[model samples]
Target: MNDHTYKITAQDNILFVDASGPFDFDTMLQYKSETLEAIEKLKHEPWGCIACFHGSGVFSPEAEEELVLLTRERMRKNMAALATVIQDSRQADIQQMQLSRVYESCNTKYHIFSDVKAAKTWLANYLKKQPN
Candidate 1:
């Protein structure tokens, strides 16, 4: 597997993103392209996202900004909710909080988790509340 690239999968209406090695501007660009393409192709209707950073390396500020922009773009494309799973670390907690702050005014439902199953469960519950 390429250390610079992330992986994305679509299960039903949930888009699953796994962050791999260290994330940089270029890596984020690739991830963005792949994720948007997956969303376009895999979305039969409205969908949400679950981003897992269990294997991810540190993210730069620029990369974080790009992530916020990507989330905004996804919102425009019918994204309903977003849940993230990150390693249990102080740095990860701080970064996730910062990211959440960026989404507070976007009127989107977002949550953070340290467990992948919990993250997916949140997305499943969130999706169940939306119109059919």
Candidate 2:
């Protein structure tokens, strides 16, 4: 995976993950690894996350499953909130529903947004509501 595939950052205890187009298994792996590293580096402090999937390419089922599992595991830990941003369409709605199912068995709070700015705002607000 190259630097252009994805970018990860942390601000105000919120982990921001922006994935570029043409997403693939390798890119998914890189994202998962880096996100986990960030969480660990923060000592598993309560945190929120904003994941922007705009322009993402086709991804494998296996990769998607792994990604969901990794996210679920984090939710079991210090994950306080999650915000997802993607295209505003039927396909995006379906994807959001599927993603929501990934957290049905957990207490993870999540919301879907059509834009990154809204998602970030939601994450900030959600994090503020969490117990310190």
Candidate 3:
């Protein structure tokens, strides 16, 4: 059974994702599917993402690999930037390490944050700067 859960919403060219994880591969696949669906519904081009991760926020290796692929696909689909929020410092570090690999490999722009407000502000500014 999949233990991970996520809520994805879009507003004004930004995708907001609230996710809690100790994710399995299936959970990652579901996340990718739902996020892509949300992306298609967005009315703007060159969107950004604010992903707030809660709880353990750890992904299995296979799940992490799937996320890497999804991140690349998101970039292809005009996801211009990503801001990730994690409250736990240790978990933040771990998540950063994992996500850094994914974002770097995809050559996607991203930042990790401890506060959701800061993440939203950064992503808003980042999206504003992107050429529509």
Q: Highest lDDT among the candidates is held by which one?
A: 3
Residue 85 miss distance in model 1 (angstroms): 0.6
Ranking by lDDT: 3, 1, 2
Give me the runs in candidate 1 sitting further than 4 Å from their true place: 1-5, 42-44, 88-90
Tens-digit lDDT string for candidate 3 (1-132): 555778999987889999988788888888999988989866358999999888777888998899988998888789999999986545667877887888898999999888999999999988889887
Candidate lDDT (C-alpha), each: 0.77, 0.71, 0.86
Runs in model 2 lying further than 4 Å from the true structure: 1-4, 88-91, 105-107
Error of 2 at 73 (Å): 2.7
User: Candidate 1: RMSD over Cα atoms?
Assistant: 2.6
Q: Candidate 3: which pairs clash?
A: none
Candidate 3 local Cα displacement, residue 94, angstroms: 1.4
C-alpha RMSD by candidate, in order? 2.6, 3.1, 1.6
